[model samples]
Target chain A: MPPETPQPQATVRDVTQILTRTRGLVDPVLRRAVQQLHPHIGEMAGFALGWRELDGTSRVGQNGKGLRPAIVLLAARASGARPEAAVDGAVAIELVHTFSLVHDDIMDGDERRRHRDTVWKAYGVGPAVLTGDTLLALAMDTLAQAGTPQAAAALRRLSSTLLELVRGQAEDVAFESRPWSCPDAVTVEEYQAMAAGKTGALLACAAAVGALLGGGSPSATAAMSRLGRHLGLAFQAVDDLLGIWGDPEVTGKPVFSDLRSGKKTLPIVAALASGGDGASRLASLLGARPDDVTLRRAAGLVRELGGLAYTRERAELHLHEALRLLEAPELERTAAGELAALARFVVDRAH
Target chain B: MPPETPQPQATVRDVTQILTRTRGLVDPVLRRAVQQLHPHIGEMAGFALGWRELDGTSRVGQNGKGLRPAIVLLAARASGARPEAAVDGAVAIELVHTFSLVHDDIMDGDERRRHRDTVWKAYGVGPAVLTGDTLLALAMDTLAQAGTPQAAAALRRLSSTLLELVRGQAEDVAFESRPWSCPDAVTVEEYQAMAAGKTGALLACAAAVGALLGGGSPSATAAMSRLGRHLGLAFQAVDDLLGIWGDPEVTGKPVFSDLRSGKKTLPIVAALASGGDGASRLASLLGARPDDVTLRRAAGLVRELGGLAYTRERAELHLHEALRLLEAPELERTAAGELAALARFVVDRAH
Candidate 1:
């Protein structure tokens, strides 16, 4: 039997309904993108379809929420940019994300993703590698067809964003082979740098491209970029929380998989720095081949050390900053409200 | 030991000497590109020095012979288009070729290139991959800054060429894993398709982009593209010949490396289809484990099966056709002769 999808919104208040509504607004744009991508991508049909076909049901369920693209649209709308002009840029970033995920799965030897066989596991390494490359090429291709003279600048933004993305992935991979005291004991500064490189760069790109293509004012684009960057930080913090504490049904991975893999998520970092006997024990147990029981024990130790509380506080601080940034400049009230609501949704929700 | 710097004009026969002479005219424009690319390229500092840091040999080399770029330049010049106007397009395609070589070496698991360790082997996979990606991005960046409005159209040519390169790689990888037999012999038709996808696509792109960027007539660009396609085919056939028969010291690879890898290069395919005892022996030897001795034996059998003779005839035929295409609609006499000279150089080289 298939695992149940997590309903993190059920126990959450206010933000649940806001997220759902915003998602509704974003759905049409995504549908049109997939539609356009499906037909006009004929020359690359074999390679393009090969990537799309690598999933069994992984792509069907528990795929990453379309958060980055939504951020692009919301930020674009807030900055008085049109939604249509921003959608392709949104699509391009999403494709980059998907491509990165495919390669990361291979590098990590990950077998399952989003509740199904990962691309590398299903299609073999060479094809999976090529699929990632094809997605990247197609991302450039889509950005080029951005329907305006401003498309060139938008593509430049996308290209720089990709360079940053590769840099982030390199850091992450390099970290994996190095020594670690505990799964979550990474320095806060290091954590922030990784988040900014891996997550914030693309989010900033999404907003910048959208605004550029939508004929937005330079100041407005800068404002949106600021908002997007903060949102990306908050989003990653929320994701790190889900990796450690969220239910397996919702996340579509074995609960505490990050601990098993020795990932140093935010909470663990805070807990490790606030050291005690438990911290020592946590350090020893990490990279020690944790089973389910060990993972539960580790979680208990993290909570006892105040890691959980510290992470939550940091996330809340960032969410507040994001909200403040969103309100700093001239924007349509409704668009600003939507962004504020999305920011709240990111922090408060479980998955 | 470092390889000696090959002189630009010394290596060229009659066919390519004129191309070497034109190099003097294009040096200033090419240098401008090298300057522009330097600021954006981070870790490619050694490469920027162009054989300087490697083994401390600062002597000038052929500067990649400028074959592909010159096609772009001369084709543009032949059609009443100024050489100055075609430089960026020329530089862009050459950059793209160098970038392709970097990535293809990684994909092919090659240890040595340009008489040195391949980028991935020398610098580690992450940096090498980034270098290739950076160069690809830089190509697009350079193309976008073209001094003409037709830059967009030229970029489409490069992007489309990239798609073809990926397709060819996919096909090559897939073909390698399939069962080996004369039944699986790639027909001349399939060979043409593969060559078109791999070699011909970029050559045609070089000529097409040059014409478009240089303000040549549409008919001229189309004719040049046709000529380039045939020239590329002839070039590959010669390369296949060298793969089997070239001196290892000159080629910088093991002699008959293609046979050991079971790469059904053109001559081998032609030999397998002839269906004689020698062909049978060659196929059986290939299907068995290939040591140095077995590969040498297989090479002898392939020769006896008329593979080398057939490939030579086929290459000469394509070279003749390229010359014919160059003469059609009558390009200016001097330019047409230069192109014919290039075709002969491409098909008749010993290495």
Candidate 2:
């Protein structure tokens, strides 16, 4: 018989507790790694991580939510591996995540992140690129120092995943330059592939590396990898949903920011693929530079065409797939319980 | 007694033969690694490596000289390790070299390299950045697959070297924006440090990784690493000298390119630090943007102030130190002979 679904109410509380506890363990490890970078670039890295201001003032409580590293730890624990054994893997994954963020901000011309000036804005583009490069190198160094027999395999997995992440980033950039109204504009499958590379691949590597470092069997680690991939898709789907519909206060972005920038996110891709009057109207509203009024109208049209509902359903489906993958027999029951809870938290989180 | 310095006549011939033979082996390994990247990015990578044109035409005879990988293999052999066993490490170093080239082209806004359009110019900046990142990830992956017990150590050394390279690059960028006439402007010592990080660190890592992967003892690897560093310093010093005095036809750069661009290379730093009338005149000739006439005058003043001779002396000193390091007892006599020859070649090469 299929495993029973996790209780939504209990899962919510458990996920919050689990993330808080995991973040407490992982953040210090990340800080230490960043500190080990060469002093000048380390300062830029510290700023990128929100550990310091551009003027070199120390700061706190402004970092990312530590979602990727938390996934690594949870996946490791769920595979019956010791959480401590996977600390390096967790830190490595987080570093890679931040590296991507720094580069992505530059590529997208994003001025702010976490309500602070992006690295490229604070320091010039050259330093910002070097900062990202430094973090990536440091991440590999951290993984190598894990001193586990599985370290080679972990490095291999992470490196390959990093390449996939770059592929996704390349495709995303290419897509942005393409004419959105063209008949051959990015299709749903192509969009999914890009998302998988950009988001799913790194998340998958995080889980897989965690499992390997934790001493999980190969088959078990593979399952964790799959679980992470689906979870990433779900996470990205929700992120796309919120990009248009999320409250500005919560997201720390302007109203309809994605629409204003003409981002071809999952929800927008789905709306464009809906094939009806609303899709045509939405297409008309987007251009080289869409004004606020048109962006508002496009958002309304996307909603009117059931794009919001479709995206929400897509996120749920992926979350279900991730949870189902967590049912592998190799996973410890308690850790699996936490995994399910984390999966729920991913899609359910408002931000 | 100190080992007899090979006659300059014999050394030049031996160095040519060694490099030509080593390149035949190393180039194939590098090509295979680049081919193994995801096809889309592999194309960009191939273009960056000068293996193919932007239109996907298979190009030939346009790649780098494979100096770094040759050092890797020769260092491996010098430590009494089989050169074949260190192929992956050699390829990894070469990949890192190309990664730096790709990114540095973007940072410097260099439109052409090897008499062809740079990756950033041929593709967009975003793709160029991703292309560099992809090569870096692939390099780490290649190292991890070496399957040697020392793979972890190799990964750590290479990652650290990569970070140092970025630090050097960051400093180079910062130094460019600083006024050359400032009292605290880049000193000779600071220039050397930047050169060590930018060029010496990677070459050192190449030799160290080669030694480790080739199963050499710790002392042998350390000696080879030191040799590589001094050799790199010699190489960069020569390159800086060429940036001003070398023929444009040979260097693939414009006449008085470094001086025209107001680059703070080693010779420029030396001329500035001369602390006299010639230095002042040279300083007056340089500005935020120098014209052809001023750049020509500045180059003449720099030479008149002994900057060219001073830089050439620095290159020879480093080359001497590199050969002295080759006296390590762990190094095989025949291989050390080849290495010494290579050291002489580095400083003596015209372009």
Candidate 3:
């Protein structure tokens, strides 16, 4: 049987309902903050946020899952503040999330996200770059203008997280130019560090910012950060799995997108490191510029080489650790339960 | 002959000496802050900052003039604080200025700056983008971690300036796509607005940040901001003139760069707005994708259309206003004299 939170199941907020509530609370603030940009930049930002079409017409489209925002509001509530007190934190983190997606699309030359054209795909690269810059600036402004020590603390953390994002991205780009199977190739340890910076930093900041804004004790903030880091690791592992095996219709990417791009994700790195017949074969498949059928075969080789199993194990391990933190007696049980649900949902999502 | 300040001329610091002194005070802090980044990211940042060669070899190269840092420290001193009190402000502003240069090079696909390949040319576009983001984050980190209310206020203002920079950049990009000679073309008023956002915002932020960090009264900060804005406009007008007429040897740019790139700068707009035979011929020159000879002719045409004299007059006009602000009773006399000297130096510099 799966482990469960200490709170009664009936008393727990369903993850969907929690996300719906968060979207309602965060979007108003988020949209208002985005509107503070130049009108043209705001339109681009709106398109990135799924609130507008490429032509600047209003549209209801697929948006982010709001997991980061949910983490913020839930962490704040668990720390004993009303969710409203941390709304700025939520909006700020969400803006950062969107900024990363917009910039990453350009960096990776990705054309589609959320089954729609990416910001760079719809707008030109320069406009997309400005949209990302606008969102990041707005994120900083939101926290800085709050005029409180808590906001300051949160801003400092957020700022550091921005560096981590760049650091991780720098590493990711560097990886592409390097060999895939030699000492010069990226290592498991190196990939972990990159993932920690790229995915974990913002998630850790999200929870910590929420707790700090909610007037939580330093210890409480640290606890939230630890849990968030584990959750981030879990999220990345799940994403690695989806990158290879996920449905294109669901993932909004080409089938075997990671394999096709020859991205040095966790599964590929683990497979390469495994050192066996399947590992050698997997490397050969990747070394060849893989087509769709070759990519599917490469996926099978990655699984046979134990890369998939090892990655899944890593994800579950992190997820369990994150869920275990919810048992801390200092947390509000209901909110903790919701966070656990959200974490599980993230790992289980199709995209 | 130039007007002189009320202070004895002998007491005014030489502009180069002020810049050299400021660089000494600010680079250590700036360098230490950048080194805190991931080694790879820091390496690219170091290159962008002119502290290293592309291959990560440390080489002293041409750096910025330290004008922004000088303003920051001078403003702090004028506000009755030790220059040391505002070193972080100086560093932060310098980092932001560097970030703008790195990103702008990539956006404009510029090849050279300061007699060297631009960051995007030295490193690839992706690394250049990451370098820009890293510098920006370091800037925020330097101020945010200061953990003082004064620092917080400075950070808040700096955050807004980031938006202004983007807004300015966005307008600059938009200007490229619009007509150059029609009613639909960029207007003089619009050019000023863009200049403020692009150039004036950071300068204003620099002085205000220094004032705030140095414990200057809010009114003093506002005064510094006003002076800084006027100085920024002067700086931009001088740059516009340089863009068209500046020697490649001094400017570290191709001669007639603005015209070659079809940049709708103030000089171009004002000349076209003059509504004369020369203006119409200038427009035709630009539309024809001018060669070396045509570019020279276009430059001559702009001068004949009164663009050159008008731009010079505008530069002098703003320079006078900025220098006049040094007469404020609240500022220390020696520092005020230095600021006036620096403001004059900026507009007069060949590059």
Candidate 4:
């Protein structure tokens, strides 16, 4: 990652058009790849991707931001290849992102996502497991079938990214078992490592795969991987903010959702690590089974202890580093500018 | 597959020596690859592979036959490469097999496997899901990191096989929602297709990957894949028999298990398709959840309707074809003989 330059945040460009265009190019390939699944699996996968309703009818609703695929496309274009050249990579990355979401929902026992019942909630656990597996299988197959020696590099990137993803998830789950405060509590550094793996790896994979397929030099691909990693951390830090303070109507999650579940996300971890009076009060409250009022108080304490500001600062730091990487001379100038816009758009989601 | 030679089934060779040798070579490679997982995940995966007890102590028990890895190594040798040359492929194939078993156990809600608690039962569902995912990631990475162009071919095979494996599992689950008897019943052909996918694809992958990695020609790899698929179908047929009539002590399952669960195995499907009085009784008995005695009678009805003979014949047909494929001029002589012995041993598991 480029050295962080703690400058004033830029007035972000609107990336909505870029995201929409990327989705237009990527979803058809993704849908066609999904069609290779058994019809039963295909139906469940379609539903998970927000393409269909529970009854298998076409659905038009709020969907994922398609952030990863957009990065893939932009990274490919930044390597001077037409975005079409990396659509398969974009599709593969999107499938993996969806795969992780479905599986994570089951693990977290959450019933809702994007304002809808989760896959397990709608279809039952067994079917949901198969659906998640199908998406992942399709993800791996997409690259393997894409074409040769370049596909090999992409596969290597994808497989290693998968390991990092599971490791991060395993660590995050491990954190939940630790004490809410004191020596055993999750540290800021611990949270960063976990976030990097859980959130950063797939993004890194997306960029690396895209650049590789778009015929980027090895050096350029490595740089994009680092860029994506930084961007992912920025993305995750912003999400930590929303988990605590964002509107339920907009975020599709309950206020202080992280607190209710005792998730060791960055904000809470940072707040608890401050060793302040608010930290002690918040810790005690969390130690007990807090009600909604108690949860509200806990959220206030986290903010009061500087967690909100601390998390925002980290997000900015990483975002600047990511934007710096996008300025490398080897990258195509226009696409790199678009990628910068996308990075800022991701961080801006918290507001 | 070669034309079925319906001459008398030869006395099956003892393949214990070949299997034991293969296990010795493959386990070390598999264990080393599994070490790449996060410690938390590695321990759970350790438990899943029967390498350690739930408490993490080393264990010794009746283990899986190591059937798939054995075929991988032997197929490599048949391609005239040293068995050592394909250990990575063997390890990759074995990991995929373990991954499938762990996930399938969860999907099937099976509590015990090989007289031990299933991974989901020992660990919680969330941890088991992660463990299974970890194993799969390791499997893909093992192939990706193995070498160059050969690794690419193995990856392509592995990814496609993964799709088939999931398809088979999805279809098998779909079958449970299907009626026991109807014009809409799961036909013999449907059952065969499902079995081929659920059981055959991985074995086919194992042999093809082994041969490709060991420098086999494309035609030789294809021949080995077909042979392994036939062997896998034969293996599934034998397992169906054990599901109904094998001793509980030997099989680790109750007698008449398939009848109790109304699994549409080859025997029951064929028997029902006969449209005889026995078939009617068997179908009606299956519609209800049969008790021990009723399950016994249902098993008897299936036998009386020629279900047992039909399934045995199918197994024999596949096993013979698999063995005949071993006679192809491309394969080395001794390794081919050992592969034939292994095929017979897999089918002989019912006895």
Candidate 5:
């Protein structure tokens, strides 16, 4: 496995270092893969990936944190597989991640991402949608060309995970128009399921694919998948927290954007389920679309009702579960330590 | 190859019988594949495929004509491959075809398809988009699971063809916004390339995949791809003709719908390229959005300018090229005859 690189004791700070190094490894592969698409599609996809400007000029910009690819590389390393061997898996997962983001921005009517205009806003919805579709097809093509013994299984896993992602997105959109008092109102459990599908499935697939491609045992792969799922849940919980309370400058969103849109995020659902004056007030405020003032008031009520604390607790619990999963004896110690560091960083990130 | 089925004299009438039998073969495979998706996605995909009502009630109605799958099966049989062995390939092609249609309907703002409300119109754009994405992922998964020795090659071909299809669609949308007076306006050659990518790529992939899975020689597979490409072009030419001149009741479109929308279809492009008095009148009529009366007059002008005759001649030329490709000695005689019949039927169909 290319002899484990010597490392000092791992700390939460090491997670950033590891992620940066992995990004350096994965970025070239990602760029080259996108460049291989048909010329027009490749140009749009490159713009969407933040590797180029809309007018076909080269640009260096925030191309996301590359967290999914990091998970993939880390999982492969933890399984005592050569991290390089999993590069295609990493590329494929990142492509899928970018695909979902492009489409999601269009569906949500979000104008900005990463402090820049969204693809739909910058180019137009038609190109944005086509760009997303092209990336998806490219993802499958990338995996099939990986030449790994496990390519077929990885393709199957990734494809099924894509279906889960789509299902989760479908449910999220459906929830928007549904009334909370209706029988079909989303339950907390259903919301968690949706989160698993939307957020967790791809993460889990990433880790599992890494392990599988790295020649890990089936049990090791399963543990990595579970670890990724828990980490995804925790990551989402923290994101929901940020959506309400984080600085707009850091989060790249308007203050209380989720609340304004009446998004049924974890904290809001918790607050609603708590059942008190604060919950009642929050519910009434959310029944219709909220203006900035109403959205601010709703966030205050959610905090007052301990919704924020409840969400933080859930995030902590999932983080704990994720770390526990990493304790499996099959994992290489140095890589497992790095994974633990990453899990902590996920919950602690400001954005 | 299943004892060559039986012998019968090839006639134009036989195309319908062959197509109907092939549809019966492919429909159940398509259904089962959709059913295997997660419940929510499966149900939505089922609705999109016209297998069920939106509310999950059973319904029997017109799905598409299943032309792509029929081509796949026919090509496989002609290559002396067991038709049953190519079912997964057929299913995958149909899924990709449906995926493109679902998204195209949304992009074009077409409210109806196959005499019913389009998926986006009936279920909203969000679900329709997700449904298309899910079907695409499922198409790859279905092909990978087919257990053919050629499965990897098939997956690669399908993914690449999908990229071409997306590129073509992107260009079509881009052309809609570009002024004809602009220096970079889509020319006749660009229109032909767009049509090749949009219509011909998938059809070519279908035939090639059929031959590959059927154990055809490389030369035979290349011939099948060429045959399919020519046939696809001819079919599109015929379709463009119908768009301008056919009965709405048979074609399931409003009279002069393409003209009303100012679609830069083949006949219109021919008329514009002709550059005569009639061409000038047609161009002037098309410059602005045309009402029904203007659209009717534009169609008349196009005919007077010999646009209709030019399109027919082009379709016939392509049909001849397709039949010439089918003359390869590698093709099984009976299957080749059936394919020729199908080609004739494509250009001859009123709708």
Candidate 6:
């Protein structure tokens, strides 16, 4: 990925408008995805999504940022592709992302998500698991409906990315049992590897699939993927910051929630490695089952130990790299500007 | 399907031999299925298959009947289609079956399968879970490589069947937890619906896919699927019998194993509904944990209650139905005869 490019602040607003408009355009496709299931499959997925238990279906419906599909559709559109040609591809990626989230919540034993009961907690594990499996099948089923070989190529990217996501999850789970310390002490390269697999893979897949559907040349698709990779890395670094230090109102999740779970986020690791007395205290509390007060204290300890500052710096570096990739000559200037703006928006957004 | 036209018994034996030869031909394809995974996916599946951790690759691979894939190939060959054309389709079905077994072992907390540690026990729950997921992905990936529209159709069958299997599993799990028995007694019809989803869906998918690849007419393919459905029902009934009464030496599983698990197998349900002292005795024992002695005694009680006779009659009925379906005018007689022989073998086998 390119590591040097003049930062363009003006394009940021342009990308935000594009994302907002594109999300509206994608709603019908999401509805079609949910509607296409065989009667039983649909009922089960609905139950798993807590359709009956929720106030309405609002909690499980298309309520998210829809960031991944937005990346997909915008990339397709920026390349002069007809939006109609690629909606299914975008929906396929979104379904895959949703599938991973539902299953991951179960594996992690997380009971609440999107401010409500998770699939497993709502419908029970059996139904939730089946629902996830159904969504995955739906994703594959979507590919057959892709109008060209481009669909095949997009699906290949999605599949490979899914494998990588699972591998990253395995590594994350494995790390929980291992003795590990602060974020700052570990090599930055290791952090990048984890982020790439866990976060960057899907983003790259999204962009590449969009490019493929948009009829971009192979090289252009490759460049778009790289741009997405850097953007994903930047996105994750910022997310790690909010996990510990952001306003709860803005992020929706409780502050320092990652710390309470003993997550090994970038900032926490960095702070452990870099801070003086605070680092020692952090190590002692690393895996402790902290109560709310203790968790808040732990977050303070991490910041005191320099986690926040170190994380912000890393996010900046990733952002600069993302911009460099977006500025490559192979991309059309307007599209490149929009993508670069998107990358900046990702790192700078509150939520 | 040709229940009326009883082909000579000798013709059935000849077809079994043909099936055995075809299995020999497809053995390499099975190997490819195991080997095609990234080293991790392969190793995890192997580990889940209960390869002893003591340096050797372990021995549980010998346990499966390989029934699903065998039927797929036989159906393909019966249509004058090259067995080679069905190899990938066959492998895909087997892997999917294996994936289900791994997850079901966890959900059921089944410690021993085929008299060895199940995947969850051998590899731990987390690894075993991922192993199932990996196998599922591999199944889809393998189907994608079929390089024909048939592959897409095969994937639809494979995935839709998976969804059905999960639904069956949910019902099974829910039944086990409920204070009352399944609201609908375990009647032949209920058992048929459960077994069709749990056992027959995959087999039906296998036959349908085989026919698709084997150049069979759509109607002929539909006939073969009906044959598979009947065969699968018969197979599950025979399996239920072995779980309770077969000699441990031949069955691999301990005698009356399903009774200990409180499984609502046909025999127990049929016996429970009977107004007999033996039915009451069996129900009392079922409510308590049964040791080997108790289990054996329970099996005797079920037999005395006529549960075993009832189960045998149902198996025979299904086997008869399957044979009739195979005898349908559209079917390839040679193939249908072989499938009929296979169904008979399933219902009559000691194990």
- In order, the candidates keep a fraction of the true contacts of 0.12, 0.61, 0.68, 0.84, 0.56, 0.06
Tens digit per residue, CA lDDT, model 1, A86-109? 767776777777777776776666
lDDT of 5 by residue, A133-191 (tens): 98998888888776556776778778778877887887787778766543555677878
Give the per-residue lDDT digits (tens) of candidate 4, residues A239-337: 999988988998788878888877878888899999968888989988879689999988998999889999999999999999999889889998998
Q: Give the range of the ten consecutive residues with the poorest summed lDDT in model 2 chain A.
A: A177-186
Candidate 5's TM-score: 0.91
Best by lDDT: 4
Docking class of 2: medium
Docking class of 5: medium
Error of 1 at B257 (Å): 1.3
TM-score of each: 0.78, 0.92, 0.95, 0.96, 0.91, 0.81
* Residue-level lDDT tens digits of model 2 in B1-351: 998876777878887788778878877888887776667688999998778988899987767777788888888888787888788888889889999999898888888778788898998776788898989988888877666677767887888788789888988887887767758778999999999999999989988988888778888888888888998899999999988988888888888878877789999999888887778777877863677778778888888888898999999899889988888676888888888878887887743
Model 3: lDDT of residue A131 = 84
What is model 5's C-alpha RMSD?
4.9
- Order the candidates by TM-score, highest first — what do you get? 4, 3, 2, 5, 6, 1
Give the Cα error of residue A24 in candidate 1, in Å: 9.9
Worst 10 residues of 1 chain A by lDDT: A38-47
Docking class of 6: acceptable
Model 4 Cα lDDT, one tens digit per residue, B1-351 = 998854224424347778788888988888887787788899998888888988778987457878888899888999999999888888888888998999998898887777788999999988888888888989998888875787788889999999999999999999888876768888999999999999989989999998988899999999999998999899999999998998877877667767766678889888888885666777788887678878888888888888899999999899999989998987899999889888877877776
Provide a comma-separated list of chain B TM-scores, one per candidate: 0.88, 0.94, 0.95, 0.94, 0.93, 0.88
User: Candidate 6, residues A93-212: lDDT per residue as tens digits?
Assistant: 777877777777776677666566777776666556667776876776677555367786776677667667776666555556655554434444666687788888888888888889
Report the CAPRI category for model 1: incorrect
Off by over 4 Å in 2: A1-16, A179-183, A276-278, A287-289, A328-330, B1-17, B38-40, B177-183, B327-330
Question: Candidate 1: interface RMSD in Å?
Answer: 5.0
TM-score of chain A of 1: 0.83
List the global CA lDDT of all models.
0.69, 0.84, 0.87, 0.87, 0.83, 0.72
